[model samples]
Every structure is written in C-alpha cells, then in structure tokens.
Target: MKDAWKRWGAEDERGALNLIGPDEVRRAVSLVKSGEVVSLAQPLSSKTPGPKHRCGLQHFMNRDGGDYAAGGRRPGGFQFSEDSVVMPLHIGTHIDALCHAWYDDELYNGFAGNSIRSTSGASRLGVDKMPPIVTRAVLLDFVQLRGKPLAADYSIGRADLLEAAAAADVQIGRGDAVLIRTGWLESQTGVTDVSFDIEPGIDVEAALWLAERDVALIGADNYAIEVLPFPAGKVFPVHQRLIRDYGVPLLEGLSLEEIASRKRSTFLLMASALPIVGATGSPLAPTAVL
Candidate 1:
C-alpha cells in the first residue's frame, strides 16, 4: 500500500487545504480577466439520477397552494410555501470531508476513526471544518481528447494527466483544484444501464502525482473520482491515499460538460462546503470564472 502520514500536523483538519494561502487566492484572481462564470454543479432534486444504493434524493413540500385549496386558512390572506429535503449529501455534486475514508481505525491527520458518531455525524474533521475553497483551477478534458467517454473500467494514469495538461497548455500548481472530465455524467441516458459500480477516473499513481504538486482539491465528472472496479487486488486506492493519507478533499459528480464545451481549461474556482456540523460530506455548487 502507499504511505500515509500528515504533513499539516496532527491537530490539523484542513490537510492539503492549508496550501491555499493568500498568495494562492491572489494568483487565482489573476485568471478572471474574461469575467465569465460557469457553474460546475449538477442540480439536486428527487428526480436527479443516482445509484440505487444511495437511495436517491427526496424532496417534500411542508406547505403549498394546495393547502388553501383544501380549506386550510391563510393568515391575513397571505400564503407562502415551505419545503424539506432528505437525501445523502454524497448524492449530488458533493465534496467528501477529509475524514470520510480511512483505514486502521485512524482518519486523516491521525484522528481516531473507530468510534463513529452516527447520530451527530463525524466526531472530528466534519464538513463544517472545511473552509470555503477559492483558488486557481485547471480542467483536464479527457473526454474530448479521446473523442468519447472513457470506458467504465478505465484507469486514468499519471501519464494521461501530463498529456492532458500539456495539451491544454495549463500548468497545475500548488493549491489549485484539478477537475477531470470523464464524459461519464453526460452519458447518463438511462437508469438500469447506468454503470454505477465502475467508472473512469484517476488511478492511485495519478493521485500521488497531484499530491506531489500540492494540489488542494481533486474533482471529477464521475460519481467516484478514482477508477471503479478498482485496480486488480486493490480497493479505493485513490480515495484512501488522497483523502486519508494526503488530506485532500474529493469533489465528485460535478458538471464539467458546459465548461469543457467552451474549451476553457484554466480559471478561478470558487466552491463552498455547507456548514453541516459533523457531516462527512456536503453538497457543493462550485463555479469557475474565466
């Protein structure tokens, strides 16, 4: 297995996020000359497509127009509507907290992971602890380069990353968010045939490569950021190494199609995790401004 340790110190919860200092933010701002902002989040709804095991997004209206029609009185002839949502935070465009995946009963930065706080959520390194992510980002359009979506079982290696970066003429730097486009999300044409178990994503080598460059975040257009069906004799190698060992956040299920279509490979990225206390993950709606 790959090595696991904390460079941000034992008490640190932000992990590689610590790399995003003032200079990183200022450098990101310099990439915004075009003033064009594009959303990189998929809409969240009960109707949103997701794997069966995730249970799907559920939405309910607490009050609506039907209330008054059913003889329910309105105060001062005024009416309003309220709604509620119940769904897994990992279902939509979401970011996994540093404590999300671990092994040997230890989380990122050596936090105890054995005693899970099921009711209250993660006892440490929850999504709330994550700061708003603002920095430079570079998109790797692997789909367009391949002329189609990569295979479900495809393992994206470090060479692929370098090739794509060179093609895009973008030099990935420290504190930058690297969003890889697999073209998998747009290939969602049906429910039963959806390849949920397997996906095309970065391999462990690629993940370590980014970690070497001190990337703050890693994202993908697929549900899982690493190749699914995993490498032979391996399981979630990227997740364990990146999130647990390197303390990098994983942004999955993003909408990179629009930005890729525009051929904008580099931009200023701004994303925030919902301040859900102790939650292991949070739904995200990141934006890229060129």
Candidate 2:
C-alpha cells in the first residue's frame, strides 16, 4: 500500500486518471464504429432504491396553469413546465471522489480526513477535481463467462478478470475504463430486499491487480463495486485498497445490460462526475459509444 501511494506522487490527487492523456482519448475515439450510444445510468425516481443512509430522488414539477405555474401564458395561451430533483450524490450511477474513502484518519494523497471536512463538505479531493473521462472501456461479463449470474457471496478475483478479458478477446490497458457486469442489477426487479442486499463484486486481490495495471476507473451494475455482506471482519477492504490506497475511483449502480447485449468487447466510453465542489461524490451519466 505504501508503494502504491508513492507510485503516483505525494501531490497528486487525480491518481489513475492521469494515465488518460491525449493519446488515450484519440484511441478511444477510434473505437467508435456504429455511432450507436448506450447510456449506462439507471433511471432515478422516487422508487429508486439506494443505500440505507441515502434517500431516493425527490422530483418536483411545476406544470402549466397551476398555482406553482412555470411561467405566464404566451401569444396563444402557451405555458412552460419546470422540474427539479434532489437526491444523494451516490444514489444513482455515480463516481466516488478521492475523498470518498479513507483509512483510519487519512484520505487519498495523505489528507487528514477529520480536518478536511466541515459543514460544507470535503475541502480537498472533492469530486470537482475529477476530470471528464473519455477512454476505451472493456466489458467483462462474468455472467457469460461463468455461465450463470454470480451468487451474492461470490467474490471475483484476478483470475476471473483475466479469464473474462481473454474470453472477450480484449486487452485491459492502462487508463482504460473497465465495466464488470455481474447481472445483479438486472436481477433486482421485484426484489423485496433493500438496495444494500448482498451482491457479487470484485475482491481485494482483483482491486490490487487493477491498481497495478493503472485502470482509470472501474464500474459495475451492482449497488457497490465490491461484494456486499462483506467477508467477516473485513469492512470494504477492496474499497479501501482501490480508493484510499490506489486513488482509483469507483463507479457504482451502472446499467450495463444494453452495452453487454451488443457483445462488443471494446468501445468508447464517456463519463464525468458532476463537478460539485467539496462533494465527496457525484451522480454520473456514463455512455458507451459503439
């Protein structure tokens, strides 16, 4: 872990994202063939399930001709409508900022966790520091590789990632965005359990492997990018290793069924966390261009 922190630099905050340069963007652009785009975000609504501590979206609309009307009538009695939404930053498909996780008392880049927070939010390593991500995205469909939807207790390790990549005939490269599809999200319809229900995700060993490869970001269709009902005595070890130690961001609650349906191994991915200053995370709307 110490070596992981030192590999980037003492002053760096963007971490693995630094691997994506002009060349990477150009390479990503070259992967687009069909010009078809698929959104990777789940629809946000009042019924949307989220973490226990986070509330789902609250949408308010001002319709035409009501007491809270959007505006006055136009030339031919035309009016406008307006809407607003409020929800936790991590509710939907989202990116975790460098400040989103910490080990003991320190955050990524060695920022003291307690000292960096106030009523407003984190004073350093906020989501606003995250740059727009444009890179090659590789989909590793574990459901297809394993011939079944992984069980809640299943832990995907380095071997699973390697085998999936090999099976897809795609090479995971530095600065690339990797989307792991466990089919968990797709299986959640009509589920009575809360959003925090057990789900399959990468294990700590696989996280370290990704960190070594310099992946810019890793996302999944599960609620969290790491297996839930965490191994006894281990509290989000994978998250600590990836975010706190390696400075790599996590994208959770992604919608990958559409992208996976295409059966393409590589595509152009565009995703950017909302630049909310001092925020620990931000809602994201990632897209895959095929």
Candidate 3:
C-alpha cells in the first residue's frame, strides 16, 4: 500500500469526506436545473445478480392484511404493513466504509486492522461514521463511448477517465463525486449471468487519479469498483489503495441508465448510507437531482 494513509490526520475517520464543504455542495446544487430525481439504486431482491459468496436479500412482511385473516383486528380502523429485510449490508447499490478493506494490518488513517473484530465489528471507521454525501457528481458514460458493455476483465485507466471527462466537458475538481457507468449492472439479466470472476472496472491508474483530485466519493454501476480477474500480481489492489490507503469509499452496483438517458453528464447527487454501526458497508438508494 502507498504511504498516503494519513493525509486526513491520524484520528480522522471521515477520510475524503473532509474535502466536502459549503462550496462543493453549492456547486452541486447549481447544476440542478430541472429538479428531476433519478434513482441510482438497483432494487434488492432474491433475483438481483450478486456474488455467490453471499445470498440475495430475503425479505418478508412483519405485519400485513394476512394478520387480519388470522383473527387479528385493527384498532380504530387503522391498518398498516411492515416488512423486514435480512441480508448482507452490501446487497445492492452501496457505499464502502473506510473499514471495508485493509492491508499490512492497518486500516485507513492507520486504524489497527485488529480494531475490526468479528465479535464487535470495526471499532473505528464503520459505516455509522459515514455522513450523508451531498456533492457535485459527474457521470463518465463509457458505455456510450464503447457502444457496448465494457469487455470482460477490461481495465479502465486514467486516460480513459480524462477522455470521458473531456468529452462530457466537465471538470473533476476536488470533492466531486464521479460515477462511471460500464453498463455492467444493466447488462445483468439474472443470477445465472452474474460472475464475480470477471467484470469491467477501473484500474490502479484510474483510482490514483481520482484520489489525487481529492474526490469525496467514487461510485460505479458494477460489482467491485476495480476490474476483475484480479490484476496481475494484485488482489483487489484498487480497494486496498483507495479505501485503506487513501480513505476513499467505493460505491458499487448502481443503476445509472436513467440519468444517462437524460444526456446530462453532471448533476447534484445526494446519498445517505444506512447508519449501520460497526458495519463495513451499507446499501443506499441514492438519488440524483438533474
């Protein structure tokens, strides 16, 4: 891992989120012209394509009309239904907390890797520590540029990001959120088609570029933020470098087709992760106000 771990200070837990301020938020709001809210999350279900290591969400209603049929009565004619979801926090579109990845026995900002215990979860840098992210976000639609799904195991590099940003005519400044659409998530038809063994994603070069820009968040419409088949001599190196070394979180499994169709490359993004204390990540139904 790079020696870039402590840029935000030893005790700091928010990481790159510290870059966001009043100005960055205002810049994002200025881009909201039409006030159209576009959902950027894939609906969670037993059918959503995901790695076999974790089972899909198992949802069930806790209260419903079925209760009425079972001799239940409504008080004051009031009726309501409630449901519960049981699954990994990373079931669908989600943000990785800085504690999600680590190397060399240390987490982001030098938090001891042992601080993350199976019994208690992360003692520091858990998803609960993450604040709601509101900022300017730019979409780099590589799908339209490539005219198809990025080839399996494709590696997106710094130059590719620069080209996309140039074509979109947007500046990827400090504190901006960059969402890259590879058409990977949209291409999935079912669980049978999902493959953790391969996917198109960013490489170390692209990750470093974003980190240097001090981006508050980096999201993509894919499984892992980095390319699959594990880069030669690397195992999820991007995740380690960004999350553990640079304090940048990864947003994965997004649904960007709607926003891309509108032909607006820049917009105001608002995302709040589930305040899951000590968890590594949280599912998010992020919204883009275009």
Candidate 4:
C-alpha cells in the first residue's frame, strides 16, 4: 500500500487525498493481492454546450496596462476582466449528489419544502453534504456483457444489469458504488451535436434493484442513466427514484474506457464531488486504482 502511494504524482489531488488513511490503502492492497480489478466512472459531457451544460468564469488582469488592482500597483495601471458561461448540471462527467433531484416536490423519506433547501426537505440534501466517496467499486460493462456496445437508443432493464454483473463475475453489495459502462463515451465524437434526443437508460426495475442492494451510488456512461424520450411527460423517474426515493447518488457521463479495458474485478475506488454549498452538482475527475 505504501508503495502504491509512492506511485502517485504530487499533482494528483485525488491520489494524494486517498493516501491519507491506511484503511483505503490496505483495502486496495488486499484487492490487488487477491487479484481484484478496479475502474473509474466518467461524467457525461457534451462538445456543444446547452442550457444545462457546464459553465465557468474567467477573471483576467493585464500585467502590462489593461486592468486595475486593489493594490494600486502600476504593473497594470488597470486590471480586471470577467466572463461568464452557462450549462446544464448534467453536462460533462458529474455526480448527482442526493440533492440533484426530487420526487413530486419531495425528497427521500418525504422531506418537506418546495425548493432545494439546506434543511430537511426534497431539495434539502444539497451537494455540500456529499463527502468523499472512498469505497469498493465494481464495474458492470453492459457493452461487453452484451457482446457489443450499448445501442444508441438502448433500454437497460434490471435484468440486463443482472446479466452484466454475471458476465463480470461480480455481485452488487451494500455501500458499493456500482458503475455500469455502456461504452457511450466513445460515441461522443461520432455525434454531430449533443442532443436531448439521446436515449433512455436503466428502467424502474433496475432502479429498484440498486436500491435493494443498498448501493451508495449508481453510474453509467450516458447522459441520463435511463431510457429517454420518456414515455409521455415523465421527467426522469429513475433519477427521481434514486435521489428522491432511495436517497442514493447518481453519476452520469462517465468515461469507462480505461476501466473496461482492464477486464478485471475489484480495485481501489475513489471519487469526489464538489463541496458547492447551494449547487445541485459539480464537475469532477473520478479515478480508479489497481
């Protein structure tokens, strides 16, 4: 385990944070010694930005002569510029903290309130409460399990997940973060644009299955982890069920190519979500260690 920690570069925050305790390291060692494999989940993002996509701001200050600094140094004489961006929470590779979604305006176990709040309510479980998710992770390669890539318009049911797990020689477990690879990340380059016209993901049964297994999180390599073009006016029942009903987090738009390529089971699983107090979600780089 100590040896593994040494392999990490100083610039790797996730790896550095992971080295804090011996427990995670020991567990990782045990898995490796026992021949277990590891995988990382990628957040789904688009090349084309949308209303719900990611946005960022850049503040610039010219050192020669453009912006103004509070210090009043003439290095710039003038010194600041700002820019803004807008995008959906679902864009890029991100994790949907417990506050990411809600039920008929209520959250899991029926919290109160109308909007996302910091207290007990449907929108109360903001991303701020999400701690670092360091646990055992198992990858379910639906694409490989199916002997092909997940169809662009594919529908994943609980049964399909069961089949995928079997193919991977893995089983869902309590507190386990299950990452299902649909191989959809590769399709990003092929699409002319990122469209909501994309597909739906796991069905209700699969949602229930994850809930039943007591999974901490469920992730996939697609925009939304359920079949889309929703039947009628359904606004992502799967997300609703997991976040609002089961109180579980969901990760989407993950790139599992590296993990899938390993074709092994068990590994050190580590991931993070931004500690944005009032935000619904944040972008992050989740990784796996062998």
Candidate 5:
C-alpha cells in the first residue's frame, strides 16, 4: 500500500480527518431524522477493570461537613459534593492518535517516532491535534451477517466488509466513520475473561480497503479495531498501515449493542477528543444520532 504522507503534505498531522470539511458536516446534519441520540461509550466503573491490566478507573469523592457550614448562612444551607477520577486515556471508548503506532522508526508524515516522545507526551501527532469529528457514519453489522456472534479469533477481510455493507444497503462514502459490530461486547457479562487475549477484528486487507475509500475513522465493538495476534509473522500490521501510513484513527471498545439491535445502518456520529496536549489518545463519549 502506498503511503498518504505526500498526498497530505509534510506538515499535515490530521490525516484522513482532513477529508471531513464543511460539506461533509452539512451532509451529516442532513441525515438526522428523529433527532434521537444514542451514546457509543461504555459506562466507566471502578469494580470492572479495563481490558488492559493496571488501567482500571479509580474514583474519589469529597463532601462538605454535615453540620459545620463555616462559609454558609445556615448549617445545612451549604452542602456540596465533588468527585475526581483517574484512569488511562485509552481505558474506555477512545480514539488513537496518529502517533500511537508506527512501522520501524518513522511515524505518520515521516516524523521520527523515537524523537517525538517526552515526559509530557508526544510532541507531534498527539491526540490534541485531532479535531472534533462530525460526519456521516455507517454501521456494518457483522453479527447480523453471520447470523451469530463471530468466533473470538475471526479475522474479517476486505470481502467481508464489502458484503456486510451491501447487505445493510449502506454506502461507504468518503470521510465517513465506519463502525463494525461483532456482537462481542453484547455477549460479555463483565470485563474479567472478556477475551482480551483474542477477539474478532478487521484484517490488514480490510485496513487497506478503508484507506482506499478515504474513511476518516474506523470503530468496532471489540477492544482493538484490528485482529489480535495478527497474521503469521506480522505485528499489528493493521495499526501500522492505518495510523502510521494512512493516518486514519482507530476507535475501540465502542458500545454498539443498542444501535446494532435497532438495525439502523446509517446515522450521524459526533465525537470530540479532549484536548489533552501530548496525549496519544483521549477517552471519548461518542454519540450517534438517528
């Protein structure tokens, strides 16, 4: 696959997102019919650890005194509660930055991968550089296509994606956000033994297919958007090609069960990554409006 670095120019960092312009946003807005909204994020819980070890969320609460209202007119008049949370940026449903993966030594736009790291985060292609994504979104429900949940190690290829799209009667348009439903998230009862070790996802061929279509982003219900333990002798080849070569961001751990159950193939997707400077990814609460 040819790299898109020269196509987007040297200083470009946003990658395929650059395809989403005012016309695309307007087209997305035109797709809204009922104004119904569905959240695409899994709820954060302290009891359940994330897919990765040591990435669980921790919560703390601070409460005002019950009877001692020193800065209030009455003892019970001034009561407030505050809370804080700590977790990895990629703990929940999140989008990976262009700097998140690379081939050997170079990142997207030919930046030195090793030289971009710092105590704060990556100096180039960080998550903060990604703008809010508002565009036409299409759902390719693989579970429905297979008539059952795919096997944990199933690797979806280019042909599978095309067949699913045709079956759903959805058009894969340029600058669109494509979400794939494997039914993996719906079958899970808890985070433990969720099969993070292996799960169904797109293969390198599918990655190249999406790149050819000029997709802005790709998301899936599974933890990683691409198959784990990849094809023989390949190490995260999908990630390397999509993020480092095509500059397409990947969305993982999405909550697509509700939308999948509804059987809607097209919707308007809106997700804005937090401007956390230097971070490789950002936890997001993406919403789909139907």
Candidate 6:
C-alpha cells in the first residue's frame, strides 16, 4: 500500500499486522495526572463566519477588567474586544451531549422523571448525567478514500464507512470513538465564507449501524454527520438515531487533515470539551498520536 506503515509491513500489503487495541488507550491515560491538561478547542473567531452569518458574540466585559463602579477606575486593563455569536449549540465546532437529544421526550440510557430527586427542576436528564469517556478512537479518512471531498449531497452509508476502513486498512472494534474526516473543514479557508445548508450526511440506517457496533461516539468533519438536504425532508436523522436513540455523543466541525496524514491505525486519540452543565453541545479539539 502507498500509505502502509514501515513496521506494519511492505507497501504491497493490504493491512497492518499490529493493530492498536484498548490497552494502548489505558497506558496513555496513566501517563497524565489530574492537573496535567491538554487543550482541544478551536478558537472562536469573527472572521470564520461570514458577513451573512449571525453570531451575536459582541464584546461585553471581560472578567479580568472592569471595576465595581460604573465606568470608574478599572481593576484590570480595560480592553475592548468584539465578537459575534449565535445561540445555536449546533453552530461551530461542537460535541452533542447525550441529553442534547430525545425520542418521544425520552432521553438515552432510559432516564425517567419518576426516579428523580424531589427538589430538582422538572427532574430532567441533562448532559451532566454523562460520565467521563475514555476509549479507543479510530479516524476514518472518508474524503481521502473517495479521492475528493464527500459530495455536497452525497449520502454517506455503511458501505462508504466500510470502504473507508478498508482503504485506511484499519479495523474498527466495539466501543471505539470513530471520527470521520470529510475534508469539508479544510475547504473553509480564510477567504471563503462557507454557509450552512442541508448537504451530504449519513442516513438513519448508518447511525444504527454504528450503534449496533457499540460505538461510544461518532464524529465527522461536517456540521451534520448526515449528508445535507436530508432524505425525506428530515433535518438531522443521524443525530436523532445516534444521540436520541443510542445515546452516543457526536463530535463535529473537526479539522482532521493533519491527523489523517499519518496513516497509523493505532494511536493515542486525546480530546476534551468544556463541561458546560445542561448545555446541548460544547467546542472540542481532539488529536491522534502514533
């Protein structure tokens, strides 16, 4: 293979002999302490979203600056910064928590209001219910496998996923944190103002396929995992199937070109997102190390 690893075997080989397993993930976690941290967030920028886009993040007041009095002596330097923000949690690079979705008003893991504590507000299952996740992650270079970016309206199916795995020569295991790279994130250049639209994304069946495989989470380089202009006029069937039905989290708006460059099947995939209580989603930055 043109991208085969040296230790894996000769270039003519179809697959690697040494595949990464769960033990590798445990060893990487053991090397880090509680305070030892890693940053995995893409900076929110005004330039990224175009003029037509609406992000209402105008500069208010920084915690470091401003005094108690009205426009009085500022404790810290009074720096005026500006930002644009929107309330859509699905906007930008974010991870959808389990509580972010519901089917028939019921959440994942079968959390019921009847079992809630007495004083809680409406006794709803929130993202806080999700415990810390530590699992094996597999990066699928879907774009590369297709020899181009995924079609704008291309429907990603289980066959495409299997083809990507075959092209990458990697085997996915149960509970794997699977990340699919579509190269769409790379197309969002400094000059381009890429707007959101219903485009290429996976169908509900594909979501069920991953869930049946017992995947812990599924991520993609696109805003929505399923192709846009969803089939049957559905908005986000992938999200509905995964988070609402299976309770699997979603990581979106990833920049995976650099990570996918190294064709290694086994690696320490490290990622962290903000622990915003009750929020539907939060920004994230995940990395894969060989």
Residue-wise C-alpha lDDT for candidate 5, range 1-290, written one tens digit per residue: 44789677878889999989999999999989999999999888775436656568888765545434555334456566677888888776888999898977898988888856667688889999999999998999988899988888899999999999999897797899999999777777655656676888999999899889989999999888888767889888888999999999999889998888777898899999999998889889999998
- Prediction 2 global C-alpha lDDT: 0.86
Q: List the residue pairs that clash in candidate 5.
A: none
Off by over 4 Å in 4: 1-29, 33-89, 115-123
Q: What is the C-alpha lDDT of each candidate?
A: 0.88, 0.86, 0.89, 0.63, 0.86, 0.59
**Lowest-scoring 10 consecutive residues by lDDT in candidate 3?**
1-10
Among all candidates shown, the one with the greatest TM-score: 3
Candidate 2 Cα misplacement greater than 4 A, ranges = 6-8, 68-78
The runs of at least 3 residues in candidate 5 whose Cα sits more than 4 Å from the true structure, single-residue gaps closed, are 64-76
lDDT of 3 by residue, 161-265 (tens): 999999899889899889999988877755476777889999998999999988988999988988998867889999988998888899998899989999999
- lDDT, candidate 2, at 80: 69
**Poorly placed runs, candidate 6 (over 4 Å):** 1-24, 27-41, 50-56, 59-89, 111-123, 190-192
Which candidate leads the pack in lDDT? 3
Candidate 1 C-alpha lDDT tens digits along 203-231 = 88999999889899999999889989876
Give the CA lDDT, 0 to 100, for residue 268 in model 2.
Answer: 95
Error of 6 at 198 (Å): 3.2
Error of 1 at 17 (Å): 1.0
Give the range of the ten consecutive residues with the poorest summed lDDT in model 5.
66-75
List CA RMSD, all candidates: 1.6, 2.1, 1.3, 9.7, 2.3, 10.7
Clashes (N, CA, C under 3 Å) per candidate: 0, 0, 0, 31, 0, 19
How far residue 161's Cα lies from its native spot in candidate 3, in Å, is 1.0
The list of candidate 3 runs beyond 4 A from truth reads: 1-3
Q: What is the lDDT of residue 258 in candidate 5?
A: 88
lDDT of 1 at 257: 90
